[model samples]
Target: MGTTGGLADDRALLGRTSTAERVADILRTRIAEGYFPPGTRLSEENIGGALGVSRNTLREAFRLLTHERLLVHELNRGVFVRVLTVDDVVDLYRTRRLVECAVVHGLGGPPFALDGLAGAVAEGERHARDGDWKGVSTANIHFHSELVALAGSERTDELMRGVLAELRLAFHVVDDPRALHEPYLARNREILDALRAGERTKSEQLLADYLDDSRTQLVEAYARRVADDGETPH
Candidate 1:
């Protein structure tokens, strides 16, 4: 009886972890697929009941997503999907330009991580061709993340991770991953090419333009989404 009880306890623990992960994936997919629009309230009770999990497990999953910036928790109100504003877009691009451009320019000398960037770009191309827009988005983010990782700063990588998470939320709202990412596929290749050729200045300039274009496109799409939904801008 004691051994059987211990086995049951282990299984229960495993089940809880699995439940949390399942909840996280469901929330992430819904957010990415735009089922729950930005600013949609996430009720723990409702979500847990719908997902067939207890409230404690749902809250644990919510905490993880909140840290990732995919959800925002409000005091007394409850958690909601984060709404990316125009000002947020502007600030996000400003930081991206400052950080990414410098990283590209600073790789003037050899010993750069062009190989990682190449791999990410290649994976993105494959996913793009396979019509896996979500996979393409993941690979695209990996490409830029690799570029920043080349700078060899843990702090920089952490900041970029947060920025990219927020950007992903914005992409979710747009609901057209191909429209948002297809244009940048070749831009990523060009950036990699410049880096390989050791043209730091050229790469930096190209990246700046790419970021500007991306910001403009994403902001316009988000505005249209908001208008269509008749939701006030955050």
Candidate 2:
């Protein structure tokens, strides 16, 4: 009887872990795919019941996503998907440029891995061709993240992850991703080419300009969205 109970407990624990991860992925996907939309409330009871998970497990998943900036917690209102403003876009890009440009210039040689960055760019292009705008957005983020990681700074990589999450949220507000991302493909390729050729300075400059243009376009998109909805985004 004791052995059977122990096995049952283990299974229950494993199930809980799986459920929590599922919740996180589902929420993340919704946010990424813009299904929940920015500033939309997420009720623990409603979501948990719908997903057939307990409230406690759902709360844990929410906490994880909140830490990632994909969700925001309100005092009494509950959690909601984050909404980014023009200011937020500018701030994120400012930090990104500072960190990423420095990383590109500081690297002595080709980083440990280039395949991941190349893969991300290729995936982004494929997603673009397929009209999977969100997938393309995600792949574009991964490409820059891998570029930052080339500097060999774990802390910078972590910071970039948070910034990218917020940026992804901003992307959800913008309807035309091709207008947002298509122009950057060649720039990304140029940066990679410079890196391969050992021209760190040129690569850094190109990345800086890319970040600037991205910020401008996202801010314009945010403004347009806000105007259309007549609601201020924050």
Which ten contiguous residues of candidate 2 have the minimum total lDDT?
108-117
Give the Å error, residue 165, model 1: 0.3
Model 2 C-alpha lDDT per residue in residues 1-234, reported as the tens digit of each score: 665776755776787777888899888877776788898999888898889889889998998898787888889878988887677888989989888988877788754367777888888889888988767777888899999988778899889877877788888787788888888877777887777777888888888888888888889888898789886553
What is the Å distance of residue 75 in model 2 from its true position? 4.6
TM-score to true structure, per model: 0.77, 0.82
State the lDDT at 40 in candidate 1: 88
For candidate 2, what is the TM-score?
A: 0.82
lDDT of 1 at 175: 69
* Model 1 backbone overlap count: 0
TM-score of candidate 1 relative to the true fold: 0.77
For candidate 2, the per-residue lDDT at 48 reads 87
Task: Compose the digit string of candidate 1's lDDT tens values, residues 56-165.
Answer: 88988998888877888889888999988777878888999999988887764864668889999999999989999888888888999999999999999989977886
